[model samples]
Target chain A: MAALSWLEWNPTSFNINNPWTWSPGSDKKVCFVTTGATAPFTALIESVLKPSSIEALRNQGYTHLLIQYGTAKDVFSSCAGAAQCNTRKDSRREALTIDGIDFFPEGLKTQFKLVQQSKGLVISHAGSGSILEALRYQVPLLVVPNTGLLDNHQEELAVAMERSNYLVRGDVKDLAPAIQKSEDFKDKMTQFPPITSGGHRETKSFADIMDETMGFLD
Target chain B: MPSPPPLSALYSLSFLLALLTTLLVAASLRLLAILPTTHTSAPLAAARRKHPHATRLLIVLGSGGHTHEMLYLLRALDPAKYTHRTYVVGAGDAFSAQRAVEFEREVEGRERERARARGDGDGDGDIEKRKPKTEMETETQAQRDQPTPPRTLRTGPEAYNIATIPRARHIHQPLLTTPLTALSTLLYSFPPLLSSPPLLPAQPPQTPYEAAAADLPDLILTNGPATGVLVVLAALVLKFFDVRGAQSRGMCKTVYVESFARVRTLSLSGRCLVWVVDRFVVQWEELEGRGGRAEFWGVLV
Candidate 1:
C-alpha cells in the first residue's frame, strides 16, 4: 500500500538559489501569514483547515500560491515527508516544511517576491504585527484568528478590523471559502488617511504636587 | 407598771423616730432614681425627621422580640407621612416562625380592625356587641390568609430589601467560657509572677463616669457589648443586692413632629408616649438652639 501511494504521488519542490532572482508580478496580490504559536495546530489543520482546501485551489487552475507556515514549527513539521505527494500523514506529518520559500530572518527584508511572477492575496493567522504589515502594504488581507489564545483577544481584534474594512476574517474551517472570495472582498477595504507619529508631550504637574506635599512635611 | 411610764410621752417619741427614718429612706431612693441618666432620643428623632421620606427604613434588631416592638412603633406612625419599611434582622429559625410571624399577623389584623372600627358608629351597646364579632372574623381571616408565615418581615421596594440584624444564638456559650478561661489562664500563669511584686503597674481607682468611658473601647470592639460580659455582671450584681423596679436602660426616641397636625393622634398614643420627659434628659437636644430649621433637623449618632 505504501509503494502504491508513492507511485501515485508527484512532488514539485522549488528552491531559492539566488537573491533578486524572483520579482513580484504587476497583479499586486499578496498574503500576510502567521499561525498563533500557542494554539492547537493539530485541531486547526485536521479539523478546521481540511487539507482539501489547498487541493481544491490547485484544481481550480491557480498555479502560483504563497503559504506562510508562521512560527508554529510543530504544525509546519507535521506537513513534511509524506508517502503521497501533497497528502498529509497522521504519523509523519510533524516533519513538514514549506518547499520553495526562503527562511529569511526578521529585519533583513521589508518586501517579498515570487519566482512565478504572479501577484496573490495574503493569508495569515491573526497577529497584530502581521495585520499592520499587510495594511502598510495596502494589500487586501484575509486573517484567520486563533480563538484558542488569550481569552480570544484575536477574535475581538478581527471584528474591529472587519468594521474598519481593513481585512476579511474567518476561522480555519472557512479558510477555503475565504480564499475563493478574496476578489469580492477587495471592494470592502476602507480607505484611511495616513497618520504621522511622535506628537505626544508630557507635563510635570504631578511632580509639582508631590514636591509641595514634601515641602509641607519638611 | 408605774403608770406605764407616761404613755403619751413614750408613744410620741417612738412615732417621731419612725417618721425620721421613713423620710431618710425616701430621700435616698429619690437620689438614686435621679442620677441624670443619658437618653438617645433627640439624636434618633433628628435622624428620622431628616430622612422622613426615606422610601425604605431598616429597623435592624437583634431578635424577634425587638422586631415586634419596632413593628408596633412603625404601625403607630402616620403612614401617609412616611411609608414604613421594616425588617427584623437576627431572629433564629424557631422565632422566625413563631414570634415574628405572630407579630406581623397581629399588626395586619389590627389595621383591618381599625379600618372596620372607623365605619362602625352607633350607640355604646351596638359597638360593644359588634366589636367582638369583628375581632373574631379578623382572627379567622388572618389564619386563613397566612397559613405559613414567612421567615423574613420585609417592607420596601421588591428589588432592594434589608435583612434584620442577627441575635447571637450562642449567647450563653461565650459567657460560660470567658470567665472560666480568664480564671484558668491567671491560675496557670501566676506562680512565677509572684516573685516580682513590683513588676505589674497598679491600676487606679476609677469613678463611674471614667469606668463607663473605659468600657467604650470594649463596647466598640464587641459591637454589642451590652449583651455579653457586661449583662452577666449586671445580672449577678442585681441578684446579689435583690434590686428591682425600672432596672432597664430604656433606649427611647422622642420625635417631636413640629407640624403635629400631620400626625395621626390616635396612632401616636398606642406606640409612643406623648409626655415630655424633660429636654435635659436627652443626650443631644435640638430646639431652636442651632438657629436654623434645616441645619438643626435632629441629632443622630
Candidate 2:
C-alpha cells in the first residue's frame, strides 16, 4: 500500500489564538454559510440573512459572515441589505463584514479553509456533499434542510448526523438558535469519517470494500 | 394438414398463457440465483489467485452530489492493484470527467512524492526503468505518447480511461418519453461494460494491462444515479446471457453504495437496484438492513 496525503485537521489540537493565522481582522471569528449548489435553498439563504441570525453571529463575537448563496442572488441581495442596515445601526456590535458568492464551481475549499483557520462555524444546507466537505475542515457545522423539497431524506440525514454529534441540525424557518449553539458545539462535535462505531462492530473503509468485492487478497 | 388450422387457431388462449407464465417463473428463478445475497466481507483469496495478472475496475460517476461522494469514496483507491480504471460518466457531464482526471493526477502526484521521500534517486532515466512494465505493450506509438515518468508507480494516463454514456433522462424531459430515453441509455451502457477502449486507438491490447483493460471489468462501483441503474441493468443482461463468459469468469460484480444523504430511506435508484446488485452498502446504522441486504460500514464519505 502506498502512503496517502490526506490532510486532516484535529479541532481538539487547533489553537484559536494563533496570531499568524491569516484573516482580514487579526482576531476575527467567521461564520460561513453554504446553500445548495444546484437548486439553491432560498429559504436557507433568506433565513441566514435575517437580522436575528446576524445578531446571533454578532453575539458570538463573529467578525465576518460569508454566504455562498448559489443562484439566489436576488434573494440574498434583498435580505442582505436590510440585515446590513440593522447591523450598522447597532453601535455596540463590532464591525462584521457580510459577503455573498453566487457560486464556486471548484468548490468552497478556500472558504472552508478560511473558516478553519479562524476557528469559525459553517452553516450549510443538509445536502450530503456540502456537509461532508465542511465537516472535513473540523469546523462547527449547523445543517439546515430544505423542507420545501418533497424528499424528507435530507431532514432525516441531518437528524441522524446531529444525533451522532457530527453536526447541529438547524431549521429553515429559524437559524438563530442553531447559530447560537455553534459556540459550545465547537469543542464537542464528533469527528468526520469516524474510525469506529460503538467499539464492538468492526468498521471497513470503502477501499477495503472495493478490494474485498474484487476478491483481492490484500 | 392445412398448416394445422393456420397455427393461430392451434393453441387455445389459456394454453398460450400457461407457456408465458412458465417462462416468467423460470426467469424469476434465474434472477434469484444470479443476484447475490448479503455478501460477507471476507476476501475470496482463492478466487483472486486464479486471475492475478491484472484487475480492471469500472466506476460510475453521476450528477453533482453523487459525483462528489463517489470521488470521496475512492480517495484511497490504489492504482497498483486495480491496474485499469474506466470511469463512466453521463453524456454532457464534463464536471465529473474532469474530476476523474484530477483524481488520477492527484494519486500519481502522491505516489511520486512518496518515492522522493524514500530517497529513490529522481532522474528521467532512473524513473523510466524503475519497475518492469506491468503490461506487455507492442505499440511503439503509445510508448512515445506516454508523458508521465513511468518507473515511479503504476498510475497516470495509461492506467485509467473515462467513458461517456447518454443520460438516462434529462431534467424537464416529459415522463412519456422517459422510457425511450432510458432504453437508449441502457443500449449505450453495454460498450463501456464490455471493456474499456484500448489504450491507443485501432490497436489490439498487447500487454497484460491492455488485455485486462479491453476485457470485462472485475467490479462495477456505483452510488445513486439514474444512469447507474441503467448500466447495472445492462451488466445484468450481459450476465444473464453469459456474454463473452462474463458470468463464468467472475466479471461485472457490482457494489452499490447508498448515498450518505439517504439515512433512513433509499433513494429511487437505490430502491430500484437493491434487489439486483451484488452488494448494497449504506452509511447509516438505521438503514443497515432495510432491503434485507443493505450492509452498514459507518460513514464512508
Candidate 3:
C-alpha cells in the first residue's frame, strides 16, 4: 500500500547512519540558501545573491556558500555543471561555483551536519520547517518571505520569530547589508528562548475535564 | 397598538423547537452509547486506582507544521509515562516519518548516554563498538570520546512507531473526489488499527479491537491535516459505536490542535473537526471561537 498524495512529491527517505562531523580544515565560513520544498524561490535567490551581493558577503567574511535549489533551475543555469553536494541519496559534497560563488544544487544528504558546520549565516525562505531547523542549532538566520505563496501565513511566522528576535528578515533586493547584519544578529540570537519551551500534554487535567463534563451532563 | 404574533412565525417556532428536541435526544443517546454501563458488580474505580496502567497515546502527525508542533508537544511529555505511543502519519509523507524517526534516535541516544553515566551497563564498550566508521562520523566520534563532550543527551522516548493512513484526497486531484476517498479510508483505518496489538506493557490483545479498547488510549491527538480528519472521525465513530468495547474504556478523547501558522483563525481542517473533537486547541489566543469552539493557549512551537 503506497501513500499516493495529490500534493507535492515527498522526497524519498534517506537514512543517516553516521552522525554529523565537523569538517576539519574548512577555514572558510559558509552561507547556505534553501527555498523550501514547494515554491520556486529562484527570484528570491537571485535577489539575495546577486553578483554584487556575493561580493558584499565575501567582503563580510562569508567565504564558502551552498544552495538547496529546489526547482530553481534558471537561476543557476550559468553554473550548469556546478558540482553537487551530498544528498541523502548521493552522499557526496561536489562543490561548484555560480558567478564565482559556491552553490550546491544537489543538496546535502546530511542537512543537520551542514547546518551545524556552517560558520556564517543561513538565508532561507520563511517556511516553518526551515525556520525550526535553523533555530534548533541556534544558527544565524535571515528569513525572506516567498511572496508568491497562496497564503500569507509564512509572513506571519517570520514576523513572530522576528519579534522574538530568533532570526532577522532580509529584503531580497538589498541583501548585502543583511549579510553584514547576520553577525550582529547571530550574537543576539542566542538570547532567544530555546525551542523546547512548551509543556507536556497534562493527562490528569484532561481526565478531570472529561469527568467534570460528564458529571455536569449527568 | 400592540401587534399579535404572526401565525407563520408561531408555526416556525414550533418546528424549530421540535427539531431542537430531536437533536438533543439524539446527542444524549449518542453519549449514552459510549458511556460505561453499571459499576455495581465491583469497585472498578478503586481497583483502577490501586493498579493504574500507564496511558497509551496515539499521535497523528500532519506534514510540515503539524509535525513540527507535534514534536514540540511530545518533547515536553515524559516518555516513560506513555510507554506505548503510535504515531499515525500520512502515506508518502516521508518527511513526517523521517522527522519522527530522527526525534526517537535523538532521544534514544540521550537515554543511552544517561544510562552509561550511571554505570548501568558496559555501555562505553558497546558505544565504541557501535560507533559509525564513516569518514564523516569519525571526526565527531573522536571528539565525543573525550573526557568532556560538548553535547548533552535528550530524553523522552519509550516504545513508539509510525503508521500510515492514505491521504483522503490526493492533493491536485479534483476536489469532489475527497468525500468518496474519505469514505473508503474510514472503513479500513480504524478496524485494522483497532486490531493491532498495543505492543507495550506486553499484554496479549484479543481481537486487536478488543485489546485496543481494553487499554483504550487516553487521547487521539492531531494537528490539523486532511489525513488527521479521517483519523479523528474514525476514532469518533469507534467511540460512539463500539464494535469491540470502546465504550467500556471510555471514549478516547480527540484533541485537534491548530497549527502555529494560523494566528487569527482555524484552518479548514480544524474547522471541520471542531464539531466533534473533545478539545480544540489553538496556538494563538486570537483564534479562539473564530470559526467554531476552541480553547485558547500560547504557541506550541
TM-score of each: 0.29, 0.84, 0.67
Give the alpha carbon lDDT tens digit for every residue of A1-218 in model 1. 32132233222232334332345444222232444332433334432224565544443333334344433445544553221245444343231223323223231123333321334456656654455545555666778776656644467557666765667886677566776676577666764212212223212121121122112121
What is candidate 1's CA lDDT for residue B194? 14
DockQ for the candidate 2 complex?
0.44
Arrange candidates by TM-score, descending: 2, 3, 1
Number of the predicted model whose TM-score against the real structure is largest:
2
Better of 2 and 3 by lDDT: 2
Candidate 1 vs candidate 3: the lDDT winner is 3
**Which run of 10 residues does model 1 chain B get worst, by summed lDDT?**
B216-225
Q: What local lDDT does model 1 show for residue B35?
A: 28
Q: Which residue pairs does candidate 3 place in steric collision?
A: A6-B170, A6-B171, A86-A92, A86-A109, A87-A109, A88-A109, B195-B208
Clashes of 2: 1
Model 3 agreement with the true structure over B1-301: per-residue lDDT tens digits = 9899877875697889998999999988986655333231121231123222344567788876688778866664444334456778877788788888887777676666655643344366554556555763666556567664222232334256677877777777797887888887776578434743454556666343334334556567788878788887788777776745655555466667788777765688987877666667676557766544566544555
Q: Please give the C-alpha DockQ score of model 1.
A: 0.00
Clash count of each predicted structure: 19, 1, 7
